[model samples]
Target: MNPIDDMDADPIDVASHWCLQLADGRLQGDALARFQTWLDEDPRHRAAFDTVARTWQAFDASPAAPSLMAMREEALSHYARRQSRRWRRPAGMRRPMLAAVAACLLLAVAGWGWIQAQPDVYRTGLGERQLVRLDDGSQLSLDADTQVEVRYNHDRRQLVLRQGRARFQVMRDPLRPFSVSAGDRTVVATGTEFSVELLAAQVHVVLYEGSVDVLPRDAATSPPPSASPPSPSTVHRAREMRLVPGQELVAGIDAADARIREVDAPRTRGWESGQLSFNDEPLGQAIERMNRYAGSHVLATGDVPSASLRISGTFTAGDNEAFVEGITGVFPVTVREEGPRYVFVQRPGTSTPEEKMTTQ
Candidate 1:
């Protein structure tokens, strides 16, 4: 095998390969140490590793984890299952590792029962977001600390945004309307582009491409405690708010206001382009957005007056350390690395207004 294939691969791909190698117990001593050192050298490395780590952890936590791992040791078992050509087809990605894992998931689970089963979950942890392209060519971008369950069937495509935020680009399929359930209501769409941010206290929706229906799932909806809980309450709109392209809707089950606004959808949904921009956005909002692209913990403590005391700029989240530094520069804050656990944000006084005015 080519030892340096990694050098030419995308950095994230290389990181994912390193993680897979580590998980397979292939690296040891110096090589492993070097990988570890490289991972620690930059915030982006940590973010990439963490992405795979969390996915692996989630897979491990599932009921089928053990069986999947067991297949790794079996001799030509996955191959034999594939050669059971009488069955017509088997599960597995074409890639070797993926093929093995996929075949194991199928065989160990007693064959072809859970096809594309929303992974039992699809999630993004704190300071991370992931974009997954569905089999139907629709795009789904998950926001930080998000968990959702997807059940796409012949009749309809359904998603339960259990927590966090997500942007969806639906493929044109009039037969199977796409629906998202959050808070008390469900956002139903047809060949449309939209996003949903399911929060503990509220929910927000933005429309980009096509039209979507916003209605309640349950009558007396309860706010989500967090994003990962199974089957949270629904959110119903007291009034119908039609949002065309470039429109945004904010729904709060607990609060009195659930309104849709005319805003720049591109600016709000800019993570897809690998660029995150803040325009007089609150410290909390900026931190929330930053956390999506980087594995860092940022908070504003000690008398955060209001959202107007905001920061504005554009930065690539793939470069987390610089992103955080660029952000903290506007504030009277210091950024420090904390032993792979967190990135601390300490404010000396208050962020300066003049500093906030600097354009990126």
Candidate 2:
């Protein structure tokens, strides 16, 4: 019986094998075309790819995940060595028994290589900013105080956001697309520029130029009909959304709902200009931004939070303590330093802090 046709072989195993083969950069012409066809032939191909992608993301967080592609290549090379070594083991008086040993050798080769060549290369520490030039000549601007890992090879160019936000200006390559993984979806692009921010419970993508194709991680994991009901076609899964400049798409924490809208993105990106901008930003959000950017603690826990507020201002980068005091001047607040952070209180006579306010 052909090894490829063995009924006991797991579909996941086959998919992983194919993913390795595709990522190995050896397939060409008909062989490559056939692999592509196979990937599109069944849903399992996609599921395997997703697993590979998630594994890639998990590896980004792990010290050993970054070098996975290299390890896979090494493992394949060793498997070939194992195959070559198999025939050299005497005349093989026990043919059937020897085949099992040969298979074991190959498995051992792959497994040991995988274990030993684990990835653990890249990482960013808190309050760190990283700038990376992608394989396609695009630029990645990592936001302050975040971490991420990258794997760019012949087959796939991927970035896993471990924390914080990043702005990507992707160079175009349809044959080899660029993708960024954050939360439950992956943002795929073709020569487009976009910024993706991963907060505690949300993933936000704001396009500055070009367009991005947002695809959910589970897009291909819909369960196969357990009983083959009358409706035999695949479920109408969510399609990718093309976000243009000034457009933003947000996916909730649980991925229950994804939202897209248009806004003044340039103004939203005021932080890049050494100043954080808010256009009627809520009191809570403004505080969160301050906390994220300030090396010193900046909390909005005073009377400033309970009442409505609206603010539009450009602040200097350093001396956040002074900046908080300046905010009091604009909005009628009394500011004081408690420890290293600033807290705001309503100007005793003014109305209570509004529930909502905008900062621009």
Candidate 3:
């Protein structure tokens, strides 16, 4: 019998019935509307539903879930046999008794699930990208050579970016703030679109929409006594910095300070579409971004003074030849082919025979 049919049924029973119906994807159309009406009929209805949902989530996440489920099925089977052999209880009594048994079993299973929920790890190889849809409806877009680990529980949603870059479309859950930790910094948001990149010794955060707080991962801890007092800029870097849309924050890994500036946020995610946009970005950094997609790396020797020179433009990712041509065309740089690798060097004052012939 449907638990909802009994108007006198316990709210938990009704809620559990609704949860099962929803989990099986059977509630739709008028039935879904009826469920909504029931939820709104009493404040207790929503609370009961949330409780049952959380309990089920916990139970499912338990490491011993399969064994517990098997035990539950066996107990239910034994109960059914005993009921068949004895005098039948009234329908009202039967429903409540069954609910009590199920509730007890769920509570027992939940104890194990609540202790730990396994984290999910995601990674992308060189020249590959990945899109992930989390259980809470948040989305993650990972760039090539990226890795992240995700862990979700009733109290919080947490992720750690071990390397590379990723864009996040976070779901709003005030009860559970979403946080991503990259290096020494952590980005916290409720509902926002942003990207975090771990580039060499720097961590870059770009906020495209909504707001976020970038703070030190261990803000509560004090530095050791042997350490010198921080500079004013370092003090500012240690405090939480709130970011609005279209702003970017760059924090150095080993340094004590950070920089925040306005940026074209949308253009920063151009790598998602195979287009890399650089706006007065250092040539060394641009080469690093390009190398994520290139099979043969493009190297700039330390002697190449132009390596620190800034370049600006959009270029196709992985097209190393085109990037080389573009760099040589504008900056005082020239390319030398070394097997599969391309090396950039400072251009000579006089044109070489090959350069003169090509120009002619």
Best by lDDT: 3
Candidate 2 per-residue lDDT over residues 77-113, each given as its tens digit: 4433443444354432344543343344344334434
Q: Model 1, 1-360: lDDT tens per residue?
A: 222143443444545446445545565777666776777767887686565444444454673677645633342343334433423556533457556654343332321223235344789876577888886898888877788788876778778888778898899887887778888767877698899886545687888886766666652122212222111122323434445677677777655456666667778877666677765556556666666555444433234443434667777765566655665556566555455423434466555333443447
User: How many angstroms is residue 277 displaced in model 3 relative to the true structure, after the best TM-score fit?
Assistant: 0.9
lDDT string, candidate 3, 232-341, tens digits? 22224446677778878888886667777888877899999988888766677777888888856555543454435676888887887788888787666677787767
Consecutive 10-residue window with the lowest summed lDDT within model 2: 224-233
* Candidate 3 collision pairs: none
**lDDT of every predicted structure (CA atoms):** 0.61, 0.59, 0.73
What is candidate 3's local distance difference test score?
A: 0.73
Q: Estimate the TM-score of every prediction.
A: 0.52, 0.56, 0.61
Off by over 4 Å in 2: 1-128, 220-240, 300-311, 330-336, 344-352, 355-360
- Number of the top-ranking candidate, with TM-score as the measure: 3
Prediction 1 global C-alpha lDDT: 0.61
How well does candidate 1 match the true structure in TM-score terms? Answer: 0.52
